[model samples]
Target: MAILTPGKPPRATSRSRSDARTRFSDRASAWLNHPMADIVLVLTASGLLLALGSIMVWSASTVFSYTQFSDAFYFMRRHLVFLGVALVAGWVTSRIPVDRLRGLGWLVFSVAGLLLALTFTPLGYGVGGNNNWLNLGGANSMLRVQPAEFAKLAIVVWGSAVLANKRRLLDQPKHLLVPFLPFSLLLIGLVVLQHDLGTAILLGGLVVAVLWCVGAPLRVLGTLAVLIAGALGTLVLANRSRVDRILGFLNPGSDLTGINHQPMQALYGLATGGWWGVGLGSSRQKWGSLAEAHTDYVLAIIGEELGLVGTLVVLLLFVILGYAGVRIALRSSTFFGRLVAAGVTSWIMMQALVNVMVVLGLLPVLGVPLPLVSYGGSALLANVMALGVLVACARDEPDAKAWLKRRATLRSKAPKRRFSAVLPGRS
Candidate 1:
């Protein structure tokens, strides 16, 4: 028996506490299992990352913009314009019918391939020694595009369509490798010729993901992995700069002022940030200490200014985005949808992992920008459009479709307000 104080309330018993916890857990599980959950999660996570990206881009680019363009907001303004364009594109993509994508996949892939091929023409230009950019308008114009970015999406859509069609025939190696392997190799070879190994690696990963989703045998996958490894090794050995970076990664203390400068500076920025960060825009690294502060090294700036907590938040958002993508893939009714969802999820997550690892000095500099967070018009546009496709897939899930139909019915049956219904003396 327990005695209660005269003026104090009695404490809750363990059984009551346990019951409360059980009820809370039940509610959470139900909410997570709701038909609308995956769609909501994807949209929310993407939105948060976009918002944060805008903020970080503005913060990280202020110094560089002011120095080069004599305007602090130059990059930010450009980023906003790109953001607006991307949002509109994403909205349009989200409305596109999933079934139509299959029919249009080849056309999209062909267009992307054409654009990529044009990168070697007179209109093509090199950036950071990689001839992977196409300059539109005159040479002085700012309207440049990276066809490799769009190629990522093209591969996902086209590869998924082809694999999904050959589902039954996938058991035969010839059927699996005929068209898909040839086309994928062509795109990857184009990217490699431009010396953009990072994009090539990503394209390769997409191929692996598509094949795995279609149930390729482990032995075949193992052979492909070895081939990819050998190719990458050969590519690395072919370039002195690439070899230097590899050596620098292996021996961090060898070249402080050369190949290791950027990595070391990134580490310094992260170290300065400590736990909470040095506070947004207060980063010392952004003040001429860090290169590509708004692009490839933006994560370093994020760590410098926002600290570990901020970095963790960004990571958590990616995790949520990845989780929603997987959920959508699992719930999809068609094999194409599954392959697409899985492909996009792998693309984003793998890119994010690579970027983060590079910034932390765990890997050599790969020039891979942090998706959505980095300041690149082409990348931002491509990523958001891909996300829109993911959302469309989520909506096409059987349960989600039923829920949406029910919602539409309810919305249609609801009473609408008349113009003068609420006005005084109006019935």
Candidate 2:
């Protein structure tokens, strides 16, 4: 009997494959075990904002709901519904791999682009002098979608992908200006057509910020800035209402009865509240003195109710959110994550700043809301989802999540057993 030689080839291949699998498993396990406190901080703050917004929206919109919808809690109910939806979106989005979002840049932007193009169709509706909403399917029985919101996200997602991919070559006009500028212009054109000047400015700002963050050359940014200014000037001239607003902005007292009514009312609302505020849910402005109290001018209502302290708190939250987001972006393992996180951070922070400024009369009324602190289903939902992404990014860091987890574990462990059960009979 001869002893057969072992199959060295198969054995060698098996060993090599096993070693490779073990190495891959080790890396995967290490990542999962990492702490994620940054994600928790962002999520906690965002959740708090949403909750506060719900209360404020109810306080701000109840009067209008009674007068316009014949229900005392119409807007409040609607806002709660939107909050639910947004939470779901946030949860779903957080579970998604951050890498998948990078590939989605074009598709997301394209859909949003189509929606923007549809604004000219009969389905588009002009409201409060802005042609921004699209009544898809029909005017009577259909969803009125705001393409601008989606467009904002698309720009963040897609623009970040581009800037990230072109990290080194963005200095070249052929790479940066040609491809980036045209699409941005196209989107900007749609927004301007909607007469949403503020959002257009915001989107423009985000693109520039994201580009610069990715290290695009200063000259390229300067050129884009000049182009944006020229384009804005042209748009302002072409639109008479926009011109009127600009003129009114320069001299708010010039037309107290007409164009300046909203700002005047907002100022009046803030002035009447004084230091401690008129108390929550007792605002006089929400009774129709200030238009869009829950949507565009909720901060005025906040001022009238929560006072300067309240406004300051709102500002501080934004500052904190901004600071946290930028930190997460800096700490991100991937370029896309950094850009996307930074882009989202910039979007919300800028919008919140713009809204507060408008409410405070530092800027023209741009109709931008205070993120989760304002009332609007679309606005709340989008913002909440954006926060979820920020949370996921923060979760990548070990120290932050680890600290939170340790604290949480300690809390759970320190608690006593159920009293009734422990006492042996109350159940």
Candidate 3:
């Protein structure tokens, strides 16, 4: 390929083909080795997961939506709108500078605090025994908002900023114990008061993940773990239904018709789906056998309608997201960016795995939806925003800067020529 074009530029036939290949190779290499790879993976995986989620939401919610709202496309349409909002939010977030975003962390955290506090007031509503939702547009409007979702993002952003600032003094447990613990506890306490144990646990996990990312010592983590463990124990003792669910999770054979009904139905749906699914929307479970098919248990519907291969594909996308997110964290130049990027990534991917585990019955049902693959507006938008933060960090990676410089250099060095070639008679 390179023989004829040795010293002089050749004609546009084989030589042009060679140049195209070269350009392709250069682009591919830059993507593979540079932090830009993270951006590519983030976009690809999020798009695939969102598309699959939309299809499965439609399939799973068809019967349920019609039964409840007399419309088959109710959940599907709402989720598509949510997706559009999230994309715009993510775009705006990605455009903001990281330092500025970090500075706004406290404001975000404070706003989330206010929202969480409002959940206990008259504007708050209960669903599935949890009063963690706020009515944003009143009952007649049918618009429900979940403040806990925003709290998760708030803790991650603010916690990262706090920890990154105190990175040097973290060796002293007191320095780590001041504002971070107090702020996290305020949110967690409010969520617990809302009777949403699942969100409390998720927020607690976020706190630990942020501290761990910023290099908190073993003693501090152990101390926090013991306190959290004791709190969880207290929670289990106080709640009979939570205890029942845990016992049922331990003994899957017991109470298949009562406390175990949901998980059992999920298992049945999965069993009904063999290898290639029952063919999209043809799953028998969605007819009347499964509950929460559109929201919390959407992945179970994914398993039932899309089959094992489809489930595996969804999981693989998560793995790619995790991989890319970790790379972005490692490539980040600033401590605050790295810690926040890692915290958001951990919170998101961990929630997904936990949700998947709930469907498989490995863990007690947590009511936590899959990251970008669930049918919840607040959660879907919050997760996409967190992803936007990661994308911003990816843009600022040192390797990303270097790649940009190299591309610019190549552009400046390449020779340019006029489009007019030597005409047969005029030239």
lDDT of each: 0.92, 0.80, 0.87
Top-scoring candidate (TM-score): 1
Model 2: lDDT of residue 413: 86
* Total backbone collisions for each predicted model: 0, 3, 0
Candidate 3 lDDT, tens digit per residue, 1-427? Answer: 5467567875678877999999999998876885477888888998898888888888889999899889999888888888899999989887778898889988999999999888889988899999988897955354778999999999988888887778889888889877999989999999999989999999998898888887878888888999999999899889999999899989999988888888989888887777888888888878877788888888888877778988899999999999888988988999988988898899988899899999998899888999898888999989999999988888878887687778989999999876977878785
- Regions more than 4 Å wrong, model 2: 1-34, 136-142, 398-427
Residue-level lDDT tens digits of model 1 in 1-427: 8899999998999999999999999998999899999989999999999999999999999999999889999999999999999999999888787888877789989989999999999989999999999999784365889999999999999988888888889899999887998899999999999999999998998888878877889988899999999999999999999999999999999889889989999999888888899898898888887888899999888888989989899999999999999999999988888889999898999999999999999999999999999999999999999998998888889998999999999999999977644777776
Write out the backbone clash pairs for model 1. none
* Shift of residue 259 alpha carbon in model 3, Å: 1.0
| Model 1 steric clash total | 0
For residues 122-219, what per-residue lDDT tens digits would candidate 2 score against the true structure? 87888787888887655333256778887878888888777677767766768866566688778987898788888899889878887777777788
